[model samples]
Target chain A: MSTRLLRLLAPALLGTLMVTAWYGVHLWLDTEMRFLLPTPVQILGAFRDNGESLGRAALNTAEGALLGFGGAALVGFLFAVVLSLSSLVRASLYPYLMILQMTPIIIIAPILVLWVGAGLKSVAIITFLICFFPLVVNTTQGLISTDRNLVELFAMWRTGRWQQLVHLRIPSALPYFFTGLRIAATLAPIGALVGDYTAGNSDGNGGGLGFQAIIYSSQAKYPALFATAAVTCALGFIFTGAVVALSWLALHRWHDSYERADR
Target chain B: MAVPPIVELREVTKRFGDGPLVLDRLSLAAQPGEFISLIGPSGCGKSTLLRLIAGLSPVTAGTLRVDGVTPDAAAAELAFVFQEPTLLPWLTVGRNIELAPRLRGISAMDRAATRQRVLDLVRLGNRADAYPRQLSGGQKMRVSLARALALEPKILLLDEPFGALDEMTREHLNEELLAIHAEAKWTGFFVTHSVAEAVFLSTRIVVMAANPGRIHSVIAVDLPRERTNATRASRAYLDLVADVSQLLRSVESTAA
Candidate 1:
């Protein structure tokens, strides 16, 4: 098959095989145990029956993720810029940043709830914490590794440090920044889900996918739980796909990563 | 003596952070409109010398003056073209050419005029909106040259700016550079490894030796001011190229 055709057909082929295997397992299971391991059809039926609530939950989670991702990007970039200003500042603060990253989100989530009083704010804060480190580290690396020749060229012009940062270092860091965003995109939904489970509003109107997962599992609604998982997976894919699209839009004109070798 | 030397290096010594000497007591001077080429072996510090003259680096000892002042003080009066085009990838050709002026707080109107003028000089008049990545290697180098020329500096320091290009492209750029230089009347310091290139572009060739990096010989190219492709084919140009090649070979052998 042509590569383009294969790219489109390969995932669909795997999904078909997976559903067949799942059905085989469904047949093999004891009648009493069948409810615990719902088949793909059962999950699809559950999605149809509870589409309204599922959609609301997905939208709520997306809001938290988007807000958190935005906060991480803005604050992380500023932090990296401040760190790039001097080695002393980077050395003094970097270890603390590492410690923050090392501390598990689970351990911090409840504490975040205690501080922020359990709502979208706490969920967003939790997601922001999860996404912040990579953005800062990658941006700092990019800013620091700007082309030395270009820096010298700027120096030749006697450009101020501020000018150097604005014109040269920041533009150079953009590819690296996008790389960080792509990484964070994959994590944003997961962080939002975790935050929701720990500190989200449990009201029917505003509860996210994480709350749905908890309610469905506790109520032994195995098919609904599976549907919730599928929605969360779709949400993650949407975030990653959106980042990839944004990166292509911003960088395809100039960056080497987007250049076609055959062309 | 009506116009003093545009650049003067008196016993200029440079070493990097207690390391071995990169350039040792190198003394030279260039008149206001002279084009000087520094040709030597790999470790001869020609690029370093250019950097020092451009005020990108400080000499560890001795004195180097540009436009009769310390290089730092004369910063606005000089521009450098690095070996790589070094154009900011995110910027369009016009924006790249306008970088120095923009940094120096030149008004948008003046910057646009300067950008157009330099782009025209380098024959990239229509590539203003194109990004550096969209350009060919030679075109990118032209943009780089245009960017330096945008400063309209009295002194131009080029560190083997055409070294990465193919021979054909290099020759084409050399001609364009000379034409621009003739019009601008800037004192030029061009660092190159090609003897033919050195002979073609410079009024005087300073051959350098590698160990401790000092000048070995300075040969004056007594060619016509208006050089062209015909100038390259002339017997005088060929002989000058051969002479400079022999001098370069001697320096390389001594360095080895």
Candidate 2:
């Protein structure tokens, strides 16, 4: 094969082998820990049997993740713009943003559920709270880290503040903002799962992937529990990868950093 | 006598916050379409004087004007090129060159023509799509020159725009600058420490001194109005260089 094809195929082959090795180990553990573990085959069978029910739960979880992720992205970007535009806004509010970021999401999710009630709203609020901080912090740093001389050149050209922000700062910050998005995309679904686990009312409408795992585990349905978890992990990977791919496609034209990496 | 000076600095002084004065009571007049070079030792406030004229900073005292208007208002017809290329790293050469007209909201077609014309002037037309990082040192400076030219500016303020380039590239750009100046006939105020460069490209050279940075003398070059590589070896060029060098030596002794 050509070097280019070899370069692309090697990583895919390595990843598949790594995953197969882990599955083998997991099957050995299933034989030892009957109630605690499930073989990959059993999990797959469980997934097939409960595919319709599981699909509905997955959709519910996806809805919460999308809602929370979109809300966080909008709020984070606006907050970054505000912080960059005014020293007063950065000084007055940034410490609080830091605090929100550092506080444990597990500790906060229960409280958010208490305040918001069970189902999509509670799950989404928790996801938004967890994912908002990274986007804001990265976007703000990227915008301010632009070249000083470029800023001066813009000033000399009589470019207005709005024009500079739109044309230069925002485009310059794309790579950083996308990095935050990738992190948040994975985290958002996990955050939603945690919220469902802690605050789900056990009603059919409220039970998502995390709640399904809890219910199956309580009943000692080990394969069903593992199956739900396998799906959640798959969701996390897919969500993260999709976001990174979307960002690369949208931004690769304007940024050399992105284009160089692609080449 | 009837024509107003293109740029005039009347007793202008500048000091950074709580620091000693860098420029004190500096006065000069740049005639229309004249090429004026300010040669001084480092820390002589030559760059500060250029910044004041560009409206990048305000004069601490006295009057600074371009075409008898305040620097900010006059800046529409002015362009400043720094020692560093300062091409926006994220932008391609063409996009960076298009910045000034783009900022002014000129029509897209006119902006494209301006970008192409300026790049052609700087001989960077083929590298329009290349990013700044991909270009050589000389090429980056050409993009900066193209950016300055895109405005079709009336006053080109160059703050040692060629200082970072190699001697060969610097000489190449110096000739290119003269050609552009000849075609456009803009008032050019350039700051530099290179005596040969000043003598070669300037109509009048202002020799400046440090320690409260003031103008020591102005020497008018009487070289043939046409300049080329051969002019660097001319007797008039060497004499002007010697005169500026003597003024520099005198300033050093006075500082001592």
Candidate 3:
């Protein structure tokens, strides 16, 4: 088979096998408590029935994720640039940044709710916090890891620091920056969902997949909960896919240079 | 009467950190339109000396000048080509050539002409839109040469620019380089390990030795001015190549 056909066949076969197994398990255990773990078909039914409500929640969650991701990209890239300027700055600031990364976002979201008050604002902050670190670390590595000969070429051109940053450092950092962005894209949604769960309303009042999932769990609506969870995963997949596409478009030519260097 | 040297080096020295000197008390002068090559064995600071002239590295001692000015000032008049073609992969052939002027903040209106001019000079005029990866090894090196020439620099400093290319490509580029230099009239400073290459390209070859690398000898190339593939087969070319080879063999023995 051709690569393109194998690519489609492998994933389709896997998904089919997984869903069949799930349905078979649901069929074998036919108890009144079977409603607790909804099967694939019931989840799909629940989504069809509550499509409007779920779509709203998913949209809200997506908005918060996108906002937080954009903020992280800008702030993280600037932070990496500033951090890379000197070893002294990196030494002084890096440990504290790493400490923040060590702290879990779920734990921090409640504190953020107290400070920023629970809403999309706090959710975005939580998402930004979770997503920022990878961008910082990866982008800094990329900026500093430019080719030595290219750096010397810049010197020969008598280029100013700003020019060096624009032409050399920025382009060199692009593939790594995109790598960081890809990480942040998937994590942003998770952060937003966790933020919604920790700080959102107890009822299905707040606008997010996490809030809806929390409400479904509380009310014993297993099908809606499973459906929302599946949709959230899909959202994450879509966000990551978009980022991957962006990276390909931007760096396909020169990005291969980094790969070649690695080999 | 002596035409003033475009580049003058006197007692120049370089050492990394507190370690022993890599280059010691080197003195040389490059007159206008001179294609001077620094030839030596591996690890003789040949590239380092090239960098010092390019002002990418500071000299440890003594004076180095381009047109009676500092290295930093000298840089404005020179373009450097590395052993690896070093074309920015992100850029097309045209954009790579345009980079020097772009870095210097030349306007697009002014640079369009110069960028086109150099691309044509290197015979990459048609390949301007092609990315670095889209080209062959020779084509990429041609782009590199075009990039340097695009700046319209007074001197072109080459650090074994064809060191990575195949022998045929190397010879082809050497011929192209001579043709371009003949028309452009810029001084050239090339560093290489091959004696044949040195003789083929240089107006004068400054043979070097390792262990605090310093100039061992300088041989003036007396081949005919207008050279072609036929020139490479001539008796004078072969004899000159032999003379440089003998000098390098002596340096290698001493280094060993």
Model 3: per-residue Cα lDDT at residue A150: 88
- Expressed as tens digits, the lDDT of each residue in A179-243 for candidate 1 is 99989999999999999998888654959988888888888888999998899899999999999
Instruction: Indicate which candidate wins on DockQ.
Output: 1
Tens-place lDDT per residue, model 3, B53-104, is 8888789899999878977877778888888888888988888888888777
Q: Which residue runs of candidate 1 sit more than 4 Å off their true CA positions? A: A204-206
Q: Flag the better candidate by lDDT, 1 or 2.
A: 1
Residue range B171-253, candidate 2, lDDT tens digits: 99999999999999999999988998998899999988899899888889898768999998888788878878888888878
Poorly placed runs, candidate 2 (over 4 Å):
A1-32, A201-206, A254-256, A259-263
So what's the TM-score on candidate 2? 0.90
Which one wins by DockQ: 2 or 3?
Answer: 3
For all predicted structures, in order, the TM-scores are: 0.96, 0.90, 0.95
Comparing 1 and 2 on DockQ, the stronger one: 1
TM-score of the candidate numbered 1? 0.96
Task: Write the residue-wise lDDT of candidate 2 on A102-193 in tens digits.
Answer: 88877876777678777788878878988898889888888888778878888887788999998878877878888889889989888878
Candidate 1 residue B250 C-alpha distance from true site, Å: 2.4
Displacement of the residue B120 alpha carbon in candidate 1, Å: 1.7
RMSD of 2: 3.0
- List of clashing residue pairs for candidate 1: none
The digit string of per-residue lDDT tens for model 1 on B132-210 reads: 8889999999999999889889998998899899999999999999999889899999999899999999999999998
Ranking according to TM-score, highest score first = 1, 3, 2
What is the docking quality class of candidate 2? medium
